[model samples]
Target: MRSPFRRPASRSARSTGVVRVDTRTKRLTKRLQPGEIAVIDHTDLDRVAAESLVERRPAAVLNAAPSVSGRYPNLGPGILIEAGIPLIDDLGPDIMRLHDGQRVEIHDGAVSHMGKTQVIAEGTLQSAESVDAAMEEAKAGLAVQLEAFAANTMEYMRGEWDLLLNGVGMPALRTQMSGKHVLVVVRGYSYKEDLKALRPYIREYRPIIIGVDGGADAVLEEGLKLHMVVGDMDSVSDKALTSGAEIIVHGYRDGRAPGLSRVEDLGVEHSVFSATGTSEDIAMLMADEAGAEIIVALGTHATLLEFLDKGRSGMSSTFLTRLKVGGRLIDAKGVSQLYRTRISGWWLVGLALAGLLALATAIMSTPGGQAFLGLSGVLWDDIINFFRALVGLSPQSPTV
Candidate 1:
């Protein structure tokens, strides 16, 4: 009689916890604690943001913007619902007024202060069925989104013609990437899994490791020293900046570099790479310009769905950049699968056993070999007899 996607009436369908509010979901994720209510202003939430929230195990997610908005079936809302976290959306800008650490109650799409009687605000409580319907609607809008994507791509190309076509404005880095394998890591998709999978490739090739923003933390988290950190410097931690990686701030072509001041304040030396795309785009551009022999990309978006999931028109740079670097570019997932450990432990053991067997065969085929074998057998028997006698047992006659 009732929809299965909706929570059952028997179970309490309310979330009560302290709220963590931020318009930037990436920055907010850094401080989100378990059971905390995340109050974000994200629209068409992407997979990476959803994954960060899932990792924090939030009590609920309250978005001031539409989670789907018919914007090409964004993956964030479905991830939250699948993780069993309640999602309340379209709460409007008024919800951002909620202060951090303010205890609140969320019930039936309404938010109320803890122990208060009046609802502060109400929103659409999204469930599995609602998200599914939204995704279908979003998919239909793909044609319109594609048209916009094409237009934006042309605009980006026109505006940054020199950079795209001629590789102009690329920063000169001390980290030598010429004729070497370069690993460019971005904090998107199944980055953790991809990074773990590339451990062997990373060890074997010892590629120049480059981390984009929070990806720097991902690198350091895995106990790897980052050779370079390239981004706007908004999402990366101070520890990552001080990690001794050459920090290259991604700046606008208009010369406005907001992230530079933060680096200056922290007293970390950095250079600015004036570009017109995402950090990952500039990272690849840098690698290509530096003449990297092979570029291994980890946690980067490579598909149309992934580009749309990022919710940015500037992803055109990624499309164009990939066209330029696609020859050398290999997805970390592919490398992990194709790469075999050059020397497997089992292979080594088998080779050792075969060598001993060959030696034994050669020894059995010769007179000198037979004499040596006989002496070895006699010595082994004598050693066993000596051990047996020391244990207070009468030794039996040695084998003939």
Candidate 2:
């Protein structure tokens, strides 16, 4: 009979690394190092989490919950596979029992303690093919997901109609947004690239900059200061919180603010705005209510798949918020495409020529310059006459 404890693969295929375990993938990624194994309990992991893991360059990922639950085509699994990272799916709760910094061997689908041959757990070793198949399955179920999304949107509308329509409960702000551009940054899809692309626009327009949660850190990383920091205080750094920005804490509709304590502990003054929906939704709403002439959104969700990737009913509010903001709001991704540097080599050359013409006009006003011009005119006529003689045509006398 075959051995019940048989390992999944031969010795040559085994991968060995120290495993880091965490219930929260975002927290785990902070300390996760290159070539380490990340054991996480994230269900239907989102694209941001997967990108964070890929950045850490983990040897392989072991998930306690399914990465793709087929609710909709989440972009995480395909991103990991595309980055050449190994992913082992649905390892069960037992995988979380593994201690952090515990070295382990992974062969095919089996995870074992290093230097041992016994299998500790096993899961489905994902490939490009398997991930593609899961995505297709998830795509087929999108209609159902959309129906649920619509239902959630209606529920959200009913609950937040006053806030959405009249900007009810929006707190007053010290930062003057009226008649000015506001740039709201969120640490989401292509945020870094979008931010880089917006440098020229930011420099020219000098828009009021607002950072949402960890996007505060992203803004600081780009050497920009925040005029206002909005969101739950989670995921943002102490440095960013203490950076003298106006803090607005997003609280639940019921008036409980979970992130309030963190800001309080830091001794930073802040205001609470209670509402349903994501923090980003509130950020945009606040800007619109404050009479901002234009609002530029960076790294915020804009597509159908992105809304589903959030795996929350709050995304419904985002849809409603967009409509409320209307023509004033523009996604930074689109801005990056449409915005140009405004300054060009031709403009510089024209400026230089204009300056030279002005300088020449000033010099010609001087008596010495008038004498120089007369000498130049006579020299030019002599050269023209020599040229005409060579061509057998008499040079016309200077106009009297």
| CA RMSD, predictions in order | 5.7, 9.9
TM values, all candidates: 0.88, 0.84
Q: What is the lDDT of residue 274 in candidate 2?
A: 94
Task: Name the lDDT of candidate 2.
Answer: 0.87
Alpha-carbon error at 37 in model 2, in Å?
Answer: 1.8
Residue 185 of model 2 has an lDDT of 94
- Put down candidate 2 lDDT per residue, 1-400, tens digits, no spaces: 2212122221226789999999988779878999999999988889988988988999999998999888888888777877777888898998899998899999888888999988888888877777777777888889998999999999999999999888889998999999999999997887877898998788778999999988888899999868999988777888989999999999997878979999999999899999999999999999999999999999888888899998887898899899899789998877777666467667899999999999999989999998888888888888989999999999968622
Q: What is the per-residue lDDT of model 1 for residues 348-388, given as tens digits with 9 covering 90 to 100?
A: 99999999999899889999998888898889989998999
lDDT minimum window of 10 residues, candidate 1: 2-11
Question: Top TM-score: which candidate number?
Answer: 1
